[model samples]
Target: MERIPILRMGKFLLITIQVDMHDTTALALQDDLMAKIARSGARGVLIDISALDVVDSYIGRMIADISMMSKLLHARTVLVGMRPAVAITLVELGLSLRGVKTALDVEKGMELLAAALEDGDAADQD
Candidate 1:
């Protein structure tokens, strides 16, 4: 079994799953991640997929599902660290991501989350 580590950075949570590049693990991890995010009440999420080499339809749909569920939980989810080859494969496979957000790296995803958090704070103050 692989380890799925979840870390909290400010209002953002990062979930890293160490698993084979397969959809089975991805789907299971996605469910666990969603539960953790909902329970933590995180404002944002960064899913580090840097270790993954393959992105099949199931995995893509799971990612998209998590993104939608995260929004319903009042948290934004971003898929980060996807390799160009994997990205191209996913696109070529015709896997629709719906409205899921993605970033080239975790740093950019964090920046986006921080900006959103600032905006949320401002809106709360007004």
Candidate 2:
């Protein structure tokens, strides 16, 4: 079985999708990421999909699901590097990805995650 690599960066988890994802692969990623978040106590997730040139409805829904699941596990998820066509496809497929945060690139994604974590910390203090 193929598995996506999830890297730990301080209090965040970084996932760079370098291969085209099949349904099984995306499912496995969701499971793996949830477990990683629970075990590592990561506060944020950053996913870079720049390498992907295409996205079907399944993959788009999976991305949205992953973001929602991460939130349930108390982690903020930021999706980065989406191509215009992929965005159009997702919209056409009616997967609004409502709860997923997005950035134009990894640097901005990282900044978003960092700021989100800081906000979470501030909320915790209150």
Candidate 3:
């Protein structure tokens, strides 16, 4: 069993998946991430998946589910560092990742997340 580490930066949670994930590992990550978000009251989540070369349908759904779950918990989710090949594979596999947000890399993901959080703050203030 592999445990994914969830790091906290201010009000955001950062998870860099450095290992090839099996179904069990992906499920575990989903569970662990939700727990961490609940415990830390994180406002955003950044998932870096640059290291992963393959993402099957199950893994694709897991990613989308994570994003939806984060939104349900009032946290914005940003998937980052997806390789071009992975993107094409995902599209061909028919997993649009419909409601999930994505970025090219971690730095850009962080910026995008910050902007989203700022927008949420503004919405709240209004």
The top-ranked prediction according to lDDT is: 3
Which candidate would rank higher by lDDT, 1 or 2? 2
Listed per candidate, the RMSD to the true structure in angstroms reads 1.9, 0.9, 0.7
lDDT for each candidate structure: 0.82, 0.92, 0.93
**Per-prediction TM-score to the true structure, in the order listed:** 0.86, 0.95, 0.97
Task: Give model 2's TM-score versus the native structure.
Answer: 0.95
Point out where model 3 deviates above 4 Å.
Answer: none
Tens-place lDDT digits, model 3, residues 1-126: 888899999999999999988789999999999999999999999999999999889989999999999999999999999989999999998999998999999899999999998999999999
**Cα distance off (Å), candidate 2, residue 101:** 0.6
Deviation (Å) of 113 in candidate 2: 0.7
Over 14-80, each residue of candidate 2 has an lDDT whose tens digit, in order, gives 9999998878999999999999999999999999999999888788888889998999999999999
Q: In model 1, how large is the Cα lDDT of residue 51? A: 87
RMSD of model 1, in Å?
1.9
Candidate rank order under TM-score: 3, 2, 1
Model 2: lDDT to the true structure: 0.92
Off by over 4 Å in 2: none
Candidate 3 TM-score versus the reference:
0.97
